[model samples]
Target: MDMASVQLLPDDVLADILRRLGPHDLAVSRCVCKPWCAVIDARRMLPADAHLLPLSLAGFFTVSWTESLTAYFSRPCASIVVGKLDYLDTDDARSLSVADQCNGLVLLHRPTLWPDDQRVLNPVTRQWAKLPPYPHLVSPCMKQDSYQREDMYLVFDPSVSPHYEVFLFHSVPYNCYEVDVVDEDAFDPAVKKMEWPPSSYTLRVYSSKTRQWETKPFIREGEAAGTIGDMESALSPGHCHAAYWQRALYVHQHDFVIRMTLSNEKYKVIKLPLGLDVRTDDEPEHYLGKSEKGVYCALLYGNNRLGVRIWFLDEICGKMDWLLKRDINLGNLLANYPWKHGDRSWTTQYVNDEIGRSMTPAGAKFESDYSTNDNVIVPEYTVSLLGFHPYREIIFFRTSFGRAMAYQFNSSEIVDTGYLQGKGPHDCVGGSFAYTPCRMGKLSNNM
Candidate 1:
C-alpha cells in the first residue's frame, strides 16, 4: 500500500495503533499529518476513560503555596518547577486551599475566614477563571440557634465534558418546635429543646457553561447531613476532602462513606471497615481515597505516628467487605533514615517550548544542601494522606515536618514523592493535591 493509503487508514484502525503509544508519543503522532490530527481531536471529543488511556500520569504537577513552587516529580526522586500561579506568586498569608481535583483541573479558594475568593485553575497552561461563592441565604451572616452544614466539591472531567462545576452543599438552621406546646401555640420558654435530626441540605451548584449560580433543595429530602465544623474551626483550613470518583462525590465519615450521585442527585452510603471506630480528638485520622485497587480507607494509628492501616473495599455477592491492603510502618522508614533538604528548583523554560503547555518532568535533583527542616528528622512525626501515584499503588502524603513522601504498596519502598511546604511552619495546611494535566482549550470551550 502507498504511504497515502497507510495515512488514510480507518479511524478505529489508526486509533488502535495510537493507543499503543505513550501519551507524549501519541500527542506527537498528531503532528504527522492532518489526518492524524483529526483522529486525535475526534477521540478527545468523546467523554470516555478509554480515550485517555495515554494520559496515565503524563502531566502530574505539584502546587506548593507555602514555597510558591508548582512542580512535578522527575522520575527517580526530585521535583521540577514548571511554573508558579500568579495568584500564588507571593509569600504572604494568602490561605489557598485545594478543594478538589478532577481531569487535571483544580478548585482553589482561600480557606481563611473569608472563603469568597475562589477560582478554577489549569496549572499546566497557567489559565484560570474566577468563581462565585455559594448564595448568601444558604449561609447566613449572623449566628442563630439551629443546626447548619456545608460541604464543597469541584466537578470536572475534561475528556468526558468541557463543563466544570462546583457544588456547595449547604444548609441553614431553623427553630425546632415540639408537640407539647402551651395551649397548642407555644411551649415552655424556660426549658427549650432543639430538633433531634439535623437540617436539610440545599445544594448550590455553579457551572462554567452558564457562568451562573443555581440553588435547589437537595433531592434526597428530609435526609440531613451533620455539621462538619463550627464557625471558628471553619475559618481554619480542614481536611474535609470530597473526592470525585466514578462520577460520584465520595465523603468519608466515622461510620460510612457517602456516595452522592452527580447525575440524579441521589446518595447512597457505603459502610466503612466493620467495627472501625475513628475519632479526631484522640484517635487516628481516617482518610478515604480511590485508586485502581478500589475505594480504601487509611487509618493512621500509633500515638507516635508509627503506622498507617490501609483497608480496600471488596464486594462479595453484593455485600461490601473490607480487606486490609497493607499496614505501612512509618517508624521503620524514619527510624534511622538520613533526612536532607535540597533546593527544589529546576529548568522549566523548555516546558512550554514545544506546545506552549506544561513540560515533561526530567526528574528532580536531590543534592543534599543540609538546609531541610530539622523537625522532619524528629523521632515522632504525623502525616496527612494525599492521593496516589496516577498509575501505581503508591500512596502520597505530607509529614508533619512539611515534606511529601510516597509509599509503594506493591514494592514495599518509600521515596520523596512531592514538595508543597518546606521548613518554617506551614505545619500541614500548605495544601497538596495530585492531578493529571488536561488541555486549556477544554475550559475555553465551556465558556
Candidate 2:
C-alpha cells in the first residue's frame, strides 16, 4: 500500500495491523509517523511483561574487547531507538563506554576525561542528564597499587519511581598513618591498618531528584568476607557485577553478595552457598539479574553435565536466601548446534597477554561427563550469560560457536535467535547490558 493510503487507514484498522507484528516491528512502526506512534501508545500494542506503554526489551549494548568497540545489537526494525548519542559534547563517539544499564536508561562514561565525566542517557527518547562530578574520598593509607579500585552502578525503576540513582563503591587501602603523642614534644607516627570489609561503608550517591551528590553510610550487618590482603584477585577489573532489584542494590564481591538496602541504609554480606562460591578454581559462570519471579542468580555448571541452575532470592522471611528454582541439562540443546567443521575453541590467549589468558575459561574442566552414553560424541562449547530479560522469564546468552539463544524458564523452551550479531561470532563480549526501550517523558531535574 502507498504511504498516503496507509496513513488514511482508521485508527482501529491501524492498531489491528500493527498488533500482528512482533515487538521489534511495533517499535519501528512507532517511528514511522505521529499517527502510528500515537495509536500504538494509546492502544498499548507493545509487549510489556509488567507496566504498559513504555517498557519492552529492545536489544543489548555489549562491550567487546576483541573488536575494541561498544556495539549495540538489536533487531533491524528497532535500531533507531539505539541512537548515536550525538547530543553528548564529544567529537568521537568511541571515547564513551556503557558503564551500566538500568531499566530504559544507560550510564555512559568517558575514562579519558579528566576527573571522569558521566552522563545518563535515554536512547529511545534521546534525553540525557549530565551528572555532577563524583565526590572524592581520600584514603589515609595510600599505596602505589591502590589506584582506588571503584565501580559504578545505575538504578532506575519506572514501576516504582521516575528518579534514577547512581551508586559508587570503592576500596580503601589497608594501613593508615596515625600520630601517637608520647609527650608534648615527642610524638610517634604509628601505622594503623584496618581489615577488609570495614564495619561501615561510606558510599557516594548521586540522585537526579536533587541534581547533586551526597554520601550515604551503610553499617555492616554480618561477618567480613576476608581481609584486604586476600582480595588481590577479587578486586581486579571485570571481576565484579551489580544488579538493582526490589528497591535495593546487590553487588557481587569476592565470595559474598553485598546487599545494600537503599531505603534502610543498611548493608549485609551474604556468603555464597558451598558450591556457588566464586573462590574455587573451577568457577562456574554465573550472572545476577532480575527475571519474572524476582532477583535471580543464573549459574552454568560444567561439572557433571552442561546444565544451568537458577536460584531465586527468597526475602519473605526478612533473610537472604538462595532457593534453587530451576535446573536443566543443556546437553540436548547443545547437540542441535554442533561446532562447525575445522572449528575449535581457543583454549588460551597469547603468552604476552596475561590478563586475557587468565580470563579465558579452562578448556579441560568442561570435558563432558557422559560416561553412560559412550557412543555419543559430545561437543564442548564455552557459553556465557549475556543478561536477563528485565520483565520476562528469559535469560539471554551466547555460545562459543557464535550463537545467541534465550532460555524460557517457565516452559523450558530454548529459542535460537540467530548468530551473535553476524556469522563467525567473536568471543569478545566482555560485558552486556539489557536495553529496554522506554519512551517516558523528559528526565526533568526536579523529581
Candidate 3:
C-alpha cells in the first residue's frame, strides 16, 4: 500500500488543513515547500474563538547584569544575560533581554555597561541583523552614556508584507535641558486634564524595505496635554493603557480615551465611560484592554468584585458606548486552584505530617492555605489583578510574593501559573510579561 503524498494534494485542500493548524504546527509546515509556504502566508487568519485557539506566548524577559564598582556612578557590568521565564527555551547566551516583539521579529536589546548594540532577531528563522542605536543615544544633543528606553512599536504582518517598520517614540534630551526643555508646566492656563492631549511625543520609523530610519509625521489623536485654556468643568488626566482596536490605536489619558484612526490618519479624544474607575485622586487599579467587541475596561477590584465593561464604538467618529459585561466576586476563589497549593517547603511539611504521624485518610489531606515570602510565612496572602490572557476571559493575578495565577471566567475556576523569577537582594526586579510569537518566512517577497 502506497501512502498519500501531501505534495499531490490540491492547493485548496492544503490550505484548509494549514488554516486549522496552530501557530507552532504552521511554522513547521513552512519547510514542506516554497508553494506550501506561500499558501500558508497568504491564508493567515485568526481563529473565530480566541479561547479555543492555542496561544503562542513566549514568556516574559528581563535584562540580567551585575553592579559595577565605579566610584562616581553605579553601572551594570559587561557580562549581560537575559533572564527569561523558566518555562521558555531562549538559550541564546549573548544579550541582556528582548526589547520588543513585532509581528514575528523580536528586537533583542543587549546592554553592556552601556547599550553597545541592538539587533532584530527572527526566532522562527534563526535570522538576526544588527540594528544601529536609536538616534537619541547617538545624537549630539543628547548626553553620552545616559540612555533611556523610548516607547516602541513594531508595525508588521508577515502574512501581508515582507517589509516591517519600527516606530520609536522619543524625546531626545540634552544633558542639561533646564534651559532648552519644553517643560509641561510651561503651558499656561492649565488646560483641563481631560482636554489635555499627547503632542510632545515624537517618532522615528525604520523600514526594513528602505533599510533606513526616517522621521515620519506622527499624528497625536488627542489634545496636547491640556493647555491653560479656560474650561472650568474639564476633568484631569487619569491612568490609562494604550490599546489597539478596530484598526485604530486608543490610549487612556487622564479621564479620556485618545483615539487614532490609522486608516484616515486622524486623532480624536473622547471621555471614558462613566462609573468606570480612572485614576484621578488615587492610583487606578483598572486596565484598558482590547477585545473583539471594542475597547474594554477591566476594573482590577471594585466593591470587592471583579467588573468588566466593554465599549461599543459608534460610527460617528470618536463616540462610544460602554456596556457592563459581568461582575464576579473573587472571594476565596484561590481556595480551589487546580494545581498543588504549596511551595517546596510546604510539600515537605505535608509529607512529614502524613508519614511521620499515624496518617489517616482524613489527616492525609494536604493543607492548602499557605504563603511563600522572603520574610514571614503567613497562612493567607493577598492577590491583585496583573492583566488578562491575550484572548481568553482568563484573569491573570499576582500574589503578595509575586506568584502568578489565572482564573477562568467561563470555567469559574482558578489555576496557579507559576511564581515569578525573584531572587537576590532586589528579588522584585525580575518580572515577566505576556509574549505572542510571530511566524517568520510567512510573507511573500511582493512587498
Candidate 4:
C-alpha cells in the first residue's frame, strides 16, 4: 500500500499508547498532534478506579492548618495528576486526632469536649459529612465522674461494610478503654443525636446494620491501663493489615500480633519474634507497609539515629527478618552547624540534578546550612517507593510545606513538584499522612 493511502489509527488507540508512556514521554507525546493532545488531556481526567489500584503510590501533603492529599498516576516522576483532596482552614478547637485512609477513603476524627462527639469522613472527592457521636455505655457508678475521665482511643476499620465504622475506645469514669461505635446510619436527622451505650467492663462491638453494640467476649491478654497511657497520650493505633490472602485483620499489639478475621469478631493473638528488638516508643516511630509480594514490612528509625531498618515478615514460619537498609548518621552533616545549644532542627536538601537517578532513592538528607534564603526547615517527612508512569523507578516524600520532593532511583538529584508554580517553603505541614492508590474505573467517571 502507498504511504499516502495508508489508514491512520484512531485517537483512542494513540491515547492508550501515550498513557502507557512515562510522564516525561507522555508530555512529549501530547505534542504529536491536536487529536492526540486532546485525548491526552481527557485521559488526565482521573477515574475512581485509579484510586483503588493496589500497589499504586499516593501522597498526603499536610500542613498545620490545611491538608492537601494528592494521588499521582504512578509515582512522582510520572507527573500524572490523578486526583486531589484538600482540607483547608481547620479550626484550632478541634484537632485532627486520627486520619485512616483505606480504599481511597479517609476517615478523620475531630474530638470535641465530649468524647466521640464530632467526627467526619472524607472520600476521594473531599465530600465530608458529620458522623454521629458513638454510642457510649457509660457506667452508672461512674456517671457522676464522666466529665473528669479523659483517656480515649479512636479506632477506625475502613474495610467494614454497609458504612465505614469508627469505634471510640475510652475509659468510662472508673474503667479503662471500652469500644463504642459510630456510622452514618446512627445519625438521627430529626433529633440530631445518637444514643450512647451503657458502660461495661468488656469490649463491645457495634453493628451499623443492626444498630446495636454487642459485648465482645474475648478478653485481650494485656494490662489495659498500661497499654493505653495517660488521658492526653496521643496513642494513635498503628497500621492494621487486612490481609487479602488470610482475609483477616492483623494488628500489632505491643509485643504480640493480633489476628481477627473479617467474618469473626474476636482476635487471635500470636507472639512475634522476641529478638527483633522493635521499639514501641514515640521517637523513631514505627510504620507498616506491605509489598506486592505480600510480605508485611515495618519501617523504623535506628536506635542510635544512624538510619532506618526495614523488617520483613515470613508468613510461612511466622518469623520476622530484618535488614538495615539505610544509614542516616548525620554527625558529619551536623558538624557544620554553628549553634551551640543543639536546639536547632536540621534538614537536608537533595542535589537538584538527581531528579531521574535510578539508584539514589527518594527522601531528604540532613543538612546544617540554613544561611541561604532558599533553605527552609522541614519539620516532618515520609518516604515511599512509588511507581510513577513512564519510569516505574521513582520515589518521593512530601514536607509539611505542601510540596513534594522526588528523586530518581539511579541519581541522587532532587525534583521539586512546586517548581512550576513558584510556591514558597511555608507550604508543608508537621505531621505524617497516609497514601494509598485508587483504582481507575467506571466509578471515577461519574465523579
Give per-model CA RMSD: 9.9, 11.2, 12.2, 13.8
Ranking by TM-score: 2, 1, 3, 4
Most accurate candidate by lDDT: 2
lDDT of 2 by residue, 1-447 (tens): 545786789976866776676545565565566666656666673344122234467777776655434656564345343545556666655567787888778887764313377888887666787788897774334443335556788888665666789998775321221123111121112312244577788889998888889998899888777655444344232535677876889887655678899888998887655353333445566677777667778776665326677888888878779988778777776675432211232211221121222212233222223212422324555677778887788988776644567788889887655445321233556677877776542365222
RMSD from true fold, candidate 2:
11.2
Clash number by candidate, in order = 3, 0, 11, 45
**Every model's TM-score:** 0.64, 0.70, 0.56, 0.47
The full ranking of all candidates by lDDT, starting with the best, is 2, 1, 3, 4
Clashes of 3: 11
- The TM-score obtained by model 1 is 0.64
Lowest summed lDDT window (length 10), candidate 4: 345-354
Distance from true location, Cα of 233 in model 3, Å: 18
Runs of candidate 1 with Cα error greater than 4 angstroms are 1-54, 57-81, 87-96, 137-149, 171-200, 218-237, 253-256, 271-281, 315-320, 338-378, 418-426, 444-447
lDDT of 1 by residue, 1-447 (tens): 334786678877866765676544555565466666556656753433233422344323344444333344333222213343444433332344456666667776665433677778776566677776667543433233333445567877543456788887542222222123112212232212321112333567888888879975444423333332221121112344556665677665333466667777776555555334433443455666666555666666666546687777674574556788887778888665555434542212211112223332222222122224542455656776766655457777766654556788888887664343332334344334556656532454224
Clashing pairs in 2: none
For model 3, residues 1-447, the per-residue Cα lDDT tens digits are 011576677877866776677654565554466666555555554352122112334333322223210000000221112222222223433333554544346554543424545556554444556555656533222334434224455454443455566665432221221233323232233222333233533456677776778765546654553432322223322112455544566655444565656566566666666453533333225556544344566554443233333334453554455665655555445544443434321110110111222111121122222424332334354444544555556656555443555666667666655443222212232212233445443222221
